[model samples]
Target: MSFVRPDIIRPPSEHASYYLPLTSGCSNNSCAFCAFSFTTLGIRDLDDVKREIDAMSLYAKSRMWMAGQPDIVYAILRQWDGKRVFLQDGDALVYPYPRLMEALQYLNAKFPALERIASYATPQDILRRSVQELRDLKKQKLGILYMGVESGDDDVLKKIRKNVSHDQMVEAAKKVKASGILLSVTVILGLGGVAGSEKHALETARILTEMDPDYAGALTLTLIPETELYREWESGRFEMITPFDSLRELKTMVEHSTFSNCFFSSMHASNYFSIRGSMPKDKGKILRQLQALLSRRDPNMLRPEFMRGL
Candidate 1:
């Protein structure tokens, strides 16, 4: 088997997180709006992955030792207060099933109190996994999945070469949820650019309502270097939506969403408004807050254009 190495790995800001780079880059690396194009895609060797996990486990322990704190080890030993792991690179789900399962099991064995293992997966990966397999994987503690359902609009999907259709995404999401895994799906605002913004927003909202993932995140479009999006901007084929317009699109999305268990978050650095709310209950409140912001169009309510790059 081929092997890949990652330059660096770090934990996410939230939770007791650690990033394990199972795959160097994304498997479906054709998204036009993605910066992942700059990175090469390859699967890492299983032995290498085991070594990485062992190293991370040691590192986590060393951190506790260096801190000279009892709380750290206590945190690890506590059942509900276990460390959360975020499998990294771009698409760690691209790892083979047996190897991925073994890695998760190994982590659990090493950590003893691992709360959950999360990873980024494309819709195609979900479609490929059987429901029973996903359930079994979940039983082994692969609890959360972060998928980029960037847009639900078929036109936008085709344009970006996301390689999945609206129907497929809906089905995949349902299966993921049914398997009892928390779904944190990301949707890109302004992917439709000026012309397709409304359609993108409405269609994406429709899908979100239908799929009703556990967590829904929205990211404003940011042009990055060496990305097809940047090239498109240079060639004048792509026109990015203003922060105001993106928020407007976001409102439309929130307004149309019917998902109850969903937690709407845009705390990502890229989005204009870091507005966060829960759904089915806080839906109306969140929508009203968003609408008020839109009506007021307060400059301070949005992230400035200069700070919007990801």
Candidate 2:
């Protein structure tokens, strides 16, 4: 079957990036809370990827539009600055290493002035590659990777079917850092629900400290309809924390997680409130902001459920 290009679902930091796809859906798609659960992974043919690149190059150099190229290509190219390219579809890093290398090589050859390339990578994918392999990709200008740590609490991770252990994620982070690639990881704020919330927050903080990522983000859990977690909530088997409770988890994480100058934030659209700053140095200030909001307990001040998006 021909590959189907997945819709753009990317990290917020990749807003300025040109969306490139080598794969669609996620290789590890069993996470209970994820929208990609049960979706089949699709690998685009190398020639198809090259065709898109060829179209991009032609458009970039001559302002000529290709007849058969997908409109999304030109739609993105119109806004692209031609500096950064973010490989798309959940975890594009899961693309086969040799093909991925060739694609990046072709990308560089076509856009020699490209500043950096990035992709979301599952811990499993990151672990599959050696540090030397990752370094080789870095040499090709693969600058950063966005990893979803989800939750550090083992029980929470197990319940969510995240598949990877906390230790494994830490090791993956280490490998990425060792490869001289900037590591940016995200943890879910309300992942443990009411029952294991505190432990989840503490363990997540511990994991973040161990990883010491260049960037850390906190996203509040937003249940999607048809997802296992959503069904659990509907059946009264799982309990979601309130918005304020999520803020409390955010507070706990910020207070406990030590960082060597990590840029940390709860600025994701799923969050009720946003706080961003350089960790360690800005920890106190961030805590104060959370405290002020938590103390108020004003429902009006928090992002309403109707306004929240995945």
Poorest 10 consecutive residues by lDDT, candidate 2: 301-310
Judge candidate 1 against the unseen true structure and give its global Cα lDDT, from 0 to 1. 0.80
TM-scores, all models, native as reference: 0.88, 0.98
**Clashes, model 2:** 0
Candidate 2 on 174-268: residue-level lDDT in tens? 99999999999999988999999999999999999999999999999999999999999999989999889999999999998899989999888
Residue-level lDDT for 225 in candidate 2: 93
lDDT of 2 at 257: 88
Most accurate candidate by TM-score:
2
**Residue pairs with backbone atoms closer than 3 Å in model 2 (clashes):** none
Model 1 steric clash pairs: none
lDDT of 1 by residue, 108-177 (tens): 8888887778888888898889989899889878998888999999999999888899999999998999
